[model samples]
Target: MSVPQAKSPPKAFDADSAQRALRLARETLQIEANALIALDQRLADGDHSIVQAVQLLLNCHGRVVVSGIGKSGHIARKIAATLASTGTPALFVHPAEAAHGDLGMITAHDVFIAISNSGEASELMSIGPIIKRMGAKLIAMTGNADSSLGELADVHLNTRVDKEACPLNLAPTASTTAALAMGDALAVAVLDARGFREEDFARSHPGGALGRRLLTHVRDVMRSGADIPAVSADTSLSAALEEITKKGMAMTAIVDVDGRVLGVFTDGDLRRLIEHVQDFTKLSIADVMHANPRTIEPQRLAVDAVAMMEEFRINQLLVADADGILVGALHIHDLTRAKVI
Candidate 1:
């Protein structure tokens, strides 16, 4: 690996120009914010376009095909991803590419959303008629409701902004922000209407933290079988200590003939026992064990076990079956290693 050298900013872009830069940034944000605010207010004025668009999307039996050209293409791809993650099946296709061969990806059951701020993208305009003729619902998101693309659409979403955030007003700044916000609004509305939930989202993102919390069960991360440190209730304290050390759990479960949990003796209990008793060579495991210890079921989520541990301030927990039989054990390290803590 090579270390890179640090360099100073150019004289033209030094601290002297920071105030101008900050002013431009704040003005850009305010302009974009105002555009979103205007959009929200417009939607509240008995707008049938948005409602009709949502209805078509919710009723779509096939995927939602989102297409755009140039800068709008970037926004369209992100919208498609957001929709897909939030329970609506969607995909992005380049307008130019769709005219070549990707149009086959669309079907009669689909709802095709075309995004173009100016509503005048030549590529999208070229195929707008064909998409509608093929029976797919055409939705146009544009700054101009009267533009060719919007006029051809079954539903036209007005993503108009008073002006661009760019100083020259040529760049698609506020318009693109408005389009992005509108897409987010659609996704959220669809997500709510479909009754999408955290668990559903977690299923789609199984490798994420929420998935690990919801999908991982106690049985999936506990120490089971011979790996458990356990002993008979009448076993000597010395033998219980040996079992705890051999299993390397710093604790031992005191069980009966059927392995039903009678009590638990851990290192914490041993330290307390030493203060109360002088010689414990003759003491049975049951005499010094903590009875009726906090236990979790094997079927519970690992995250639930973590909550139980935190609530009780216990570092170790026992897993019991319906019959009160000790099935397994867990140490805080187990949860940590499983990334559930």
Candidate 2:
């Protein structure tokens, strides 16, 4: 058997060389920055076509159909997802599919967003007339305004870049980045124009942690009823500790005969009381408990409870209503377990 050739040794890292590499990266970033700034200037040139298109799109009764191919397709899909997630109803459709039967997805009241770096994607050309004939507005995003798609569009947003970040100066590097950024800007602009709120966004992402944090009310995760570790104000500290231990909570609530909450006695309070009085059996829970403990309403958000805990530097809290009645109890771990922390 022929002997295998020795593998090349790994290159050693030099701090000076690393600094030079970072400097080069910083320099390349300026090129993309300048491209975006130039795009801003072009938009500011007041051609008004893209702005008018956006205004019309915002008024659209149907979905926004975003179509593109290759690298542009990826950016268009992201833009579509962003718009739909925010407030606008939008979806991505491949131009190649439009040439088949997917063109039927477009409606007269919808808006079409087409992406083509060279503005001459042949696949998009066949679907352009179909969208127009359907009375749908066409918004073109391209690097060249003079290309066929740009010329035919009702509005053309220029994404012209000075040069590609690639060493060959031919790859879709800077141009694609610029197009994606412009797409985000448009999506956010429309989102803001439509008055999209956090609650609206949460609706789009209900299964996500953000939605859980926003949509979950205090009652959803609070321990309520008999699960609440509560004791009458006349109860002894030893009895409160028993309730706390039985409930597996570090604290117990001091309540009135009407079940209304009066105060709370925490492990911290027990520690302090232990330092002064060795006899917990003789101490009443009312004497050792902290009167007027911070409480939350059942309708309050678990996120708000976390903020309160952080602000108060406390780990446990009682849930009560306007009548000061003990309805539930919440611990910091509760929020953590709910992934609201």
Candidate 3:
């Protein structure tokens, strides 16, 4: 055994040192990128292993159990999360933990994925056979196909990298990158084959921004009842201005006796009216209101209202029914408050 001596601390971070750092970073990125390119090329070479793995996942009646050791465990957890969020039922169980009691998480109908760069992680290798005997199909992601884990797998995905990004070539850099890329490829392919939609992904991530955009409806954010600013068609323009100010929506909807939307009066229309007419106090609402205002249905998504507002270049919109009667109102601020903007 040899005791390695520690080196002195780094010098001041000057231009020369910055260049060295940049060069190393660029080389590391290029190496990892090359590894991904090689993985893609290998998959392109008439490899049905990935296809088989995807099929197994698609047909899985239970959750996909992913297990790995060391750095591979991190990648496996990410793969499990991606799969679960994209419509697949999946979870990560540490290989060592599975050897203890987590093995019960695996059922006969589930698909088990074991990731090991060298295909010889003792923990995973020990439990892999047990999971297979339990009737769960096994998929192996490894750099070595001849290793025991690969041999025990129903399908093997080769994640071999020619070399590592680490200058010593002993660190897990390129190998872990390749394994993660392959895992992502599998999850994406399975989700695509399963016809996963954005809304489905949102369902799995309801607290996320996409969930707010997809799951939130116009009715959920729109101002209804006393909150909606409205007036009759025959009302004076001065009175409509009061409704707009009272509602703080900067606009007012004009409906007929049947409560059907006929027009809209906005601050912009008011400004234009003021510029033209000096004393228009007696002006009727119908005379100044813009006819046929853009309207949206309450059942429509709040995101759709955002699109409508952007397209029409307006701030306020009337929520209407199939009969074109006003039900509620929406302002850009409402969407902002709901985090749907």
**lDDT, candidates in the order shown:** 0.93, 0.88, 0.93
Clashing pairs in 1: none
**Model 3: per-residue lDDT, tens digit, 1-341?**
99998999978999999999999999999999999999988878887799999999999999999889999999999999989888888999998988899888889999999999999999998898899889999999999999999999999999999999999999999999999889889989998999999989889888999999999999999999999999998898888899999999999999999989999999999888878899877789999888998899999999999999999899999999999999999989999999997
Arrange candidates, best TM-score first: 3, 1, 2
Residue 267's lDDT in candidate 3? 92
Alpha-carbon error at 253 in model 2, in Å?
A: 0.6
Error of 1 at 336 (Å): 1.4
Per TM-score, the best of the predicted structures is: 3
What lDDT is obtained when candidate 2 is compared to the true structure?
0.88
Query: Which residue pairs come into collision in candidate 2?
Result: none
Which residue runs of candidate 2 sit more than 4 Å off their true CA positions?
Answer: 1-27
In model 1, the Cα lDDT at residue 20 comes to 83
TM-score of every model versus the real structure: 0.94, 0.91, 0.95
> Of models 1 and 2, which has the larger TM-score?
1
